[model samples]
Target: MKKLTTGLASASLAALALGAITPGVAAASPAPSPSPTADAGRSAGPAAPIVSRIEKHGADRIALLGVAPWAEQVRMQFDGGGSVEPVTDGRYTFLIDKTHLGKTATLTSFAGGIEGESIDVALTLDEDAAPGIIPVMPRVLGVSKDSQGVFVIEGTVTYDPLQFDQLEVTASTGGMPIRSVPDVNGTFTLTIPAEFAGRQIGVQAHLGNKSSAVDTIDLLETRPNTASDTHPLAILSPWAGAELAEPAVTFSGVAIPNSQIVVTNDAETDQRFATLCETNVLANGKWTCDSPRLPDGEYSATVTEKPTWSSVTEQTEGSSFSIVHGDWKPAAPALPHLSSITDSGDHLIVRVVIPGASRASLEVGEHRDEQQGINGRFSFWVEKSLAGQTATVAGLVDQSVGKALDIPLTPIADTITPAPLTAPVIHHVADEGGHVYLEGTTGYAPFEFFTPGVIAKKDGKLIGSTELTYNGAFILRLDEEYVGDEIELFSTRNLELSTATELVVAETEKNSAPETFPLEVTSPADGATVPATSPTFTGEGIPGAKVRVEDTTAADKAPVLVCGADVLADGTWSCEAEKPLAHGEHTTTVTEAPFWVSAGTPTTTRGFTIGDADSDDEAPIVVTTPADGSTFLAGSDVTFTGTATPGADIALHLGYGLAPVIGTADAEGDWSVSRWLGNAPYTATVIQSKNGKQLSGAHTGPTITPAS
Candidate 1:
């Protein structure tokens, strides 16, 4: 026998007899088999051919048959005829190799007279393979119903198989089919039929090989219709039938939720409306409408609803009311009537009357207000420009308005005038110098004066008539004239006219004897030296005569010494020198009895050095001591000594750093100062002053050091 090929092993073994069979021909049976059973069994007729059977167990083994009932040795042949030891007791076995599971195989047996029997069979192995199972039905999510009693089904489905072909859905109600579909996600729409509007239904989902659990859904009828009468609508404010302006009239009211509103005039024409325009009502219930201003006439407005009560209804018969135009009347007593308007530079006043009215209003341009006065007699201040210009005033009564009346006026001016004149009188007298004095007076608000004419011939033969002052009175000084020379005095109010007033004039020489001298000075003789103390003067003339000694250089100059009257009783004149004079010559003049004239031409001319020593030079010496550009600390002692022309008065002036400082020097040419210096540069100057006048020379100094 040949070894079985790998391909045929499985098929060949599996086709063999079951485990109960034995393999190979029966062992050669003993020839004496007949004697064994005695002659009765008669010799085993030609030893029964050794018979063998083969069988397979599980999938890996094949059994072979043995010859005797319990024969042990047995052999088998596979499809390729290869022999293999097999199990005894009629069992033969071979593994159905996985490699040959799908191939065909044959097994044959050979024994005695039993011809070879061949068994051909296809091989099969139990398989553990499992196929994926997936659901084919879509998930039923939810359902929706429309007013028409139609139902809409919505959901999604999943199919994982590559060859999946179709899906189907079916929905039923009370076991009655309602809808069906062939695609997974496809929708199914159906009407429940009017009879089933409020009924319940069951829904089911199906795929090719699977069906989903059933779910229940309910369908409901559409909302019921709302009744008009149950929802009352009222015109809360501008009540129905109210009439208003055509361009603008407001109407307001309240209504039920979702209710319809309509408005119209008597003619049934719709009026424009707005719900927000109405006030005092909830948003869901309020409404307002504006009507065009009606003509000046009567009309009616109506608010209504159609189809009073039906589900689909019409507007109602509106509540109707009458509207009439408003009575717009002008208030009484029209602006007061002005007859005329006049003004002074300051104010304008108007004349007006309100006939039968007690109070009236007056208006200038746009101004108006009630004015008070009985029978409307009122006045108003008019502006200056309104003067001489026309203004209008209207008169009104009850419902009757009147037109305005125009008025005009003029202003006045002011003036002034002059007064009259009067005539004057004259008087005359003569003095010891043969001079004549004439005086006169004029009678007028402010009197005038005139020069009296002298009558050389007593008849006014004066060559020229002198014109005197035009003021109240006059005085004339006439020079010497012949004694007893018939003089006349004449007065005239106007020089151009020949009018005159004359009085006999007699020239009498008064105080004929020459006046005696009243005073003379005896002390401080001419050219005498005087000290800085009070200087005295003795005078001899008339006892108790008034006298005065004046520094001639200081005379007629401002700031001169003024003497009191008592200084003259002792025939002595005295005065204190306010300032020291330099060592030099100075002249002092004396006057007596009267102050206008000098007694004898400065009776005392003197030269005296106010210092202890004297020098002859009259020219002032320039001092350079306390030298220029010198500086000292504050509170430092400073001395200045300089020699100048003999009679020069040297005054040292201390100035604050470029500013003027006040100080003084005595008659001697020496100066010393003990002053604290300020905190700035300073200048020191030497000044020569005499007779209230000064001459200065300057030198600057460095800034003073402030004391620590």
Candidate 2:
């Protein structure tokens, strides 16, 4: 504006630089007037309260210590009010939320006004509270220190815990505290607490908060510091001793330098044995352990660990041994040894001698051989069948002190035998028509053909014998019952006898007979009494003949004539009489065979009546009742009666007097002749066929039977 006043003072310095570039121009700041160095860092005495110490720096940061550094804008709050924006430097890293695990967090930090730090951090996100504490050790796989100074700790206790309590178990050369309890699958059983029995301990374990790091186990009872005229630990042999079959037994001793020789067997009750080889007594006190095969006897060898303070003077007073084993001894009753034996082909050799004995035990019957080898001599062999035998040789003189002696052998009978057959022979001939030819001679074995007695039509057919092979031969087939036969040839091991002189047979030719005719009863055509049933015996032969019906008064009876030959197609031989003929007067005989010109006289004969067994005396009134063999099927129903004869006329007959007389018997004589009697065997003869025939008498009416 020194230009308008310089252009209006440059527009009033561009309006105070557009009012300090507008925007409330610092709210027109007239209030900072009482500043005094920012009011001495503002504080209400207690507002100097940031006082922080928010430690917890692992698992996503926290460390906010403050005595003044302005606590770097802290303000963390979380526990679902979820704030955590802190971290300007006082170290606050808050992303929390692992579901805010057991949360509770605070951390405030007001700036210039001085209220700097406030802290209450907790959120640990449970990482199992830093777990991983598994240490409970006591591993002694197998320990042995026995001489009575006692050392037996067999162990295993890895990582144990289940409310675990007492277990300090220490042992470097010193150990004790074996109380245990872990059996529900956790497994722990400790036992070493006999007040630490004989020291050397150094094993450690102590659980609960855990502490286990030392493992040295060696309570070696004794056997190391030797001096003062040593040699007093003798068990010259017997950790395990027995010499029956010999192969194991070596327990030598003279210990002092760490003495331990224990070889027990006062019948061992758990003196726990197994220590096959330990020897360290060398200052000239010798020691050895070589026992494994033991089996026959008594033993006791003791020196059981001694040397801790030393005190065991040349001890050796427990020996009661015996292992006499070389069984099978019994041969001094004067020498004739070998009592029995046998083996034919594959090797069976025997030779025996046992005077004193080096070794000998051989029994064959029930097989026995105690390391057989008697220097005087002995041999044995037997595979399967000891033909007929016996063997016994028992001689054992020193099998570590046990003596034996016996001898006996005898086996005989095998002289090579089996052979017989000299010039065996047989021959027979007829060759052409009826075929009869046999020839033989064999040293080969195997031939047969025999027959004896019962050869009718040609006199006793005898071939008697011929096992052959030392001479074999065969052939003979004369049909027609061996046509005029005559056979006899023998040779089965020298029974020599043969003969078959030109036999011949051939003659057969004759066949022309089968045509006869004469069996005629045409229908009911012969003494007809047509209805008690079954009647059809027509005739004419040879179309397959065989027709029979003979009741010539019953007894060995003969019924079969159910017809065939095409009934009437002309070669006519009809049949049908299976049953219906009892009322007396039935002489129906129709036999046929091979043809039949009456087949020998009776191809037919019919009389049929079967209705007269009823002459009434009160029980015989079965009128014309038909069924003991009634096969009449044509229109069925045929019942007729006749028993009311106290006065006489009870006439009823369907066909007995032959065909047609249906009913008549009223005063309770009961008459029923229901018609339809068409098919065959009918003879309803309650006769009196009518007044003048006279022989037809018995008609006592009403009796229609058959329901029971």
Candidate 3:
């Protein structure tokens, strides 16, 4: 599959308020301290209501934008019986049935009643008189060095994806554009020749009429130790040029089974090329590392081992292979952003937006037809003689493959019956006492009734299955001994079945839970406002239990499964989001999965706002215990204290924009922060804000000289 992993950063916005002012520093105003309020720890209040909208994209799908910071506690039901699924970044999408063209969707807030905030939104849409094109662009995530010292590029193509069917990666050094590698799901990975290393390369995607903005990445220089002579490692199977059908395969060979092996792409130039695989060699002297999901491409896998008997590492020549999926590698875009398939009895209807394709075909089993692509849209129907057949829509711009959709067909009894083909939404899965309980909502469609089911499996063996109620709500309880098993929640629409969502019942027999399930967040101080987008989340949980930190800001908010570390023996854990959260009040919840303990785990929640979007005019006051111009040794803990608006976040910046320490003020409007200092002449200041606005002036902090 094509791997579009590239990304681009937006320019930063300027802050408004100045906290404390100090002489001899330019623009040295810091933010004031933060204070907790009555609404502290609350996820949603009357401050902001959820936003909802319904609009048609191209001609096939409807874009449902109901995601808001306040959407987590909201329950939704549509007037026409159609269902929606949450996508990335708090957004959702659903197929637009012609029967439900003029329908409405109602959202009722406070579904969880956790914050007592109530509101409602009714979204209605009319057929578009003037359809607009949805823009798509390619993003280059990064470039890595492979075992053979080549660079591999990865990134994604995003947007409603009206067009841009071709992908290319070229270096500033100028060579023919590397065009069209096999891609899957809009992401592509290409191996760069060794000569392109250490140069700035422009990665772009192309459509018949337009191209995406060029994303650039500087390839790292190749290291001299490309081949290590001392390491003992060899790939045992799948020799060079071997062909594999699966996206992922296991690479095993002889090595110090108990030692560490770094396996990587032989010619990719990214830091991740060298992946450490720890091992237990089988009795036959085979060690293994499962390769990551790879797109269609030629790749060489290399392995290096650190033997237990020697400190020196041994490297072996890599094994090369090819992964071939389908024949068509079209530069045409995938179906527009919200393309979908509907099962209609003996036939399945497919609709998608494929820009610039004059000819398109809907292929199901042995049936194929020349379909038209109009206004970046393609809609057609194919005979569904066999249920569960894979549906493919191949669109061609000038007879070349440009866009394609591979949708799975669900079985339906007849055209008159409606089915909830959308997948069920899993709400929560936890261990209550010694039983595992799974709860969620089933798929729904107008005039269609859904029967949800829960399936339990271990090691690919079906352990159990049960049907659920007609209310679209399901509760499945399992024995505690099945803690490590995998559970799937599914719903059946008409004769068509929705895709299942799998959740693992964590194994926690060794690291027993504490009596009260200790999980508490220390930073952002429960409703404290800070300027940073990705603030650090620090807390304590059961020492051995796996803690899942979820951005519970909205019901549609996809949880961040593992943002940080495993719980330390001391029970403390710290993690931060790889990307920044939305710029508003966000509710974050930490829950311990069913690990070591048999009892249900209590969840801990906190709320905080990301400030610094809008500027505040008020100046803040910052006061540190150590007076300005004082001297101290390196590695000494220093305490910084200040005052600000009762709830403003105080950011203590040492030097200029370096070593920032944040603290929230107490009810008394006083705040204290502490951190260790390395050897340097430190000038202190603070930046204060709430909801991205400065609440006070920047406060100038004391300066201390750190002695070596």
| Tens digits of per-residue lDDT for model 2, 15-56 | 111111111111001111111111122231111112222335
User: Residue 208's C-alpha lDDT in candidate 3?
Assistant: 39
Candidate 3 Cα deviation (angstroms), residue 12: 44
Which one wins on lDDT? 3
lDDT of each prediction vs. the true structure? 0.35, 0.34, 0.46
lDDT of 3 by residue, 209-272 (tens): 4565676767763322221221135675456787765466567665432345667776777766
**Candidate 1 lDDT over residue span 1-708, tens digit each:** 011000000000111111111121001111111121111121111111122223345566543222322122223334544444333333344544344544555444333322122333444432331222233333344444556656555433332111122334555666567655422113233445545555666566554465656655565434333323323466643545544322245565544323345666656443443211222212123344555544455445556543212343544334444444344222233233333333323445444543323334445565453433322234444555545555555544333333355555453211000012223234334442333444433222110011112111133323111112211223333333433455443332111112344444554333211133334444344545545434433334321223344455555653233221111111222333423555556665554432111122223333333323222333454544556555555424455555543434444444311112223454554434443343333455654433323333333332233333
Candidate 1, residue 384: the lDDT equals 58
TM-score of 2: 0.13
* Per-candidate TM-score against the hidden true structure: 0.16, 0.13, 0.26
- Which of 1 and 2 is the better model by TM-score? 1
Evaluate candidate 2 by giving its C-alpha RMSD to the native, one decimal. 57.0
Question: In model 3, how large is the Cα lDDT of residue 325?
Answer: 51
Clashes of each: 57, 67, 78
* Cand. 1 TM to true fold: 0.16
